[model samples]
Target: MTATDGHGLRADAARNYERIVVAAGQAFEEAGSAVTLEEVARRAGVGVATVYRRFRNREQLIRAVFQHIVAAEIEPAMAVETDDPWRDLVSSLEATVEVLAGRKVVLAIARETRALDLESMRRFVATMDRPLRRAAEAGVVRPELVARDLAAVTIMALATVHPRDPGGADRKRYLALLIDGLRPAPTVLPPPSTPDVHGV
Candidate 1:
């Protein structure tokens, strides 16, 4: 998977870039965000100068790794057959959790650094539109449910993936509970509230 930021790179440079990102993803997953550029260079089998030439700083490298994860890991979860909309939605979410569960520290760094690619996020959200709409039409999910809501729920469920629980039982349990909330409810929820950015 190519980084969203990659542009006009020569063939050798692109290969080096891909290697660095792959190495960085593994390093971040294993050792958290504190792993150094030199370490990433060593892991990539590239010189430290090569890493420096590609990414000016740690944040840049982290953002590229984040983008790579989104492309390689998260995006594929949504590519499902449309024969069963509800099943597709659930499978997509479960796949997302499976990809994310082992990389909690990398997730924390992504949030802390705001290393999100909004355009890529938008594309993923768009992929959910058809399944979500079909599920609502079948009355399997609440009509009010939207793609952004699923995105938010996925983020919420990630917190349940404890480092100690290698099996991810708690993550599955909590995510199941959250998914249950998406079903049509007897009582209607109050209108959703938007937090005031100016107040914050």
Candidate 2:
């Protein structure tokens, strides 16, 4: 079974799983998702069989890597909160943008594998719920804005990130504009084209 499946793995197996994920992250950073499982196995110092045992396919390994990166970089931003929900929301969005923009190879893999990312996106949207709710309650953001809307806002901002510009100047500019749109406003939003799959 995979790392998250069935019972927990034994200590040795758990170490291998972690190694494979870490190695895959490195490989993906260097080579994108097209890197072979054998290459990841080599980087992890594990046999190919071990890699196959933990992840049935390349897609599975990429998903694991995606989850690993999100946990390492994004979840911390999601968890931090202060008395000011608007500030908290803005901080979290900035962190998210920085992480995603800095990892261009990871973003390319994620874009190529979008068909398999609905569940991951659902989990991400769920994490934004508390901040969005608090922002609306505090009258800092429009009540009509939802967690899914924040997800879209992030996507819109990320689209402006320039690969050659390590500082992400354009990303910050567009993100600030999108953040302004979140402020309490008289404009009524059209019904979301896509429903919130995680149900808030």
Candidate 3:
């Protein structure tokens, strides 16, 4: 489905859909992919038929849950303001890490599907290109660096920071080091010598 049929859903149906998605997100986070659809329906105070009607299958429900969480969390962080592009990038990364930490279901989905294929990773990097370019142009991040490099670094840092059992301090320290490394370095130019004298 390209779009939700907002008009078609009765108020009660809409509420049921919303509740199911929310419950699914929480359940998936706590229980990973093994969480049952029946449990989601139970948590939402709705019937199993309602949950299935809204989301045909487990994968669809998982994707919808992810999208719902992203709309709530990451979308807001993208609106942050900072004159320093590097700072903005750091802030955005921090926001992303925080969201991922809170929503283990997203991580579980990624692990289950092995979703970080080249095309998907490329699209992910592309999404950050505009912001990274702005940061680079503003001299906040290294001008020679590209979005792909940043994406790789961020992914690596997240991996180290988010172990099977991660802590808040680990996340903060790793991200801090990553952000520090992303900052632009000062450029150096050699001193000019005086001009040569003309021949007599």
Candidate 4:
């Protein structure tokens, strides 16, 4: 939000901005980028013009909502205190997935639209990189596991929590399986369903 005085937002403008951002954050979390500006404005109890004044376009509003969510939910999880890297890692993963469970569409749009270059997204990746490196170095997980891999695991695990499985039993089972696989223990994995079928 740009300040009219170049120092801080005026009292009313700040409140409007906060309301619109908060409303958009919830909308995106619930409906992702598919949520419209009018819906956001309605949720915020503001006029569409007010939302438009603060966010010039849909892309700008989406990015703002993403930034708000990262700051409110995801960044704080990064501070989860624990002595065990494995527990710390898994706890963070669980917490993150809980947040992302509602925002899959937004995440997909952000990635597929190449918004990875956004400063907020870049900061998220940089913050996650540290924990990923630590988990690998401490042998808490597979050595090759990366932050993006954790994201993939979250997606796969939470995909089961969608409307098709509203009770979330599948989500829980998938998450448990994912956690088991992450442990640094030797175990036999099921054979691939189709091994070299293409034989290319």
Best candidate per lDDT, number?
A: 2
lDDT of the structure predicted as candidate 1: 0.79
Instruction: List candidate 3 stretches off by more than 4 Å.
Output: 1-14, 114-130, 144-150, 162-167, 185-200
C-alpha lDDT values of all predictions: 0.79, 0.83, 0.69, 0.71
lDDT of 3 by residue, 1-200 (tens): 33335567667777787899889888887787788899999999999998888877787787667666556666566557677666677777788677767876566685576543344444455556777777878887766666665665666666665455556777688878877777767863243232222110
Point out where model 2 deviates above 4 Å: 1-7, 194-200
- Indicate whether candidate 1 or candidate 2 has the larger TM-score: 2
lDDT of 4 at 2: 43
TM-score of each: 0.83, 0.88, 0.71, 0.71
Name the 10 consecutive residues with the lowest summed lDDT in model 4.
Answer: 191-200
Per-residue CA lDDT of model 1 for 1-200, tens digit only, reads: 54434576776788899999999989988888789999999999999999999899887887888777767776777777577878888888888778877677777887787665565466656666766787898889988877777777788898777768888888899999998998898876565555332111
Candidates by TM-score, descending order: 2, 1, 3, 4
RMSD of 3: 11.7
Let me know the TM-score candidate 2 reaches against the reference structure.
Answer: 0.88
TM-score of candidate 3 relative to the true fold: 0.71
**Residue by residue across 1-200, what tens digits does model 2's lDDT show?**
44442346676787888899989888888887679999999999999999998889877887777777677788789889899899999999999888877667776786687623777777777778888888899999988887889988888998887767777888999999999999987888877765644443
C-alpha RMSD of candidate 1: 4.1
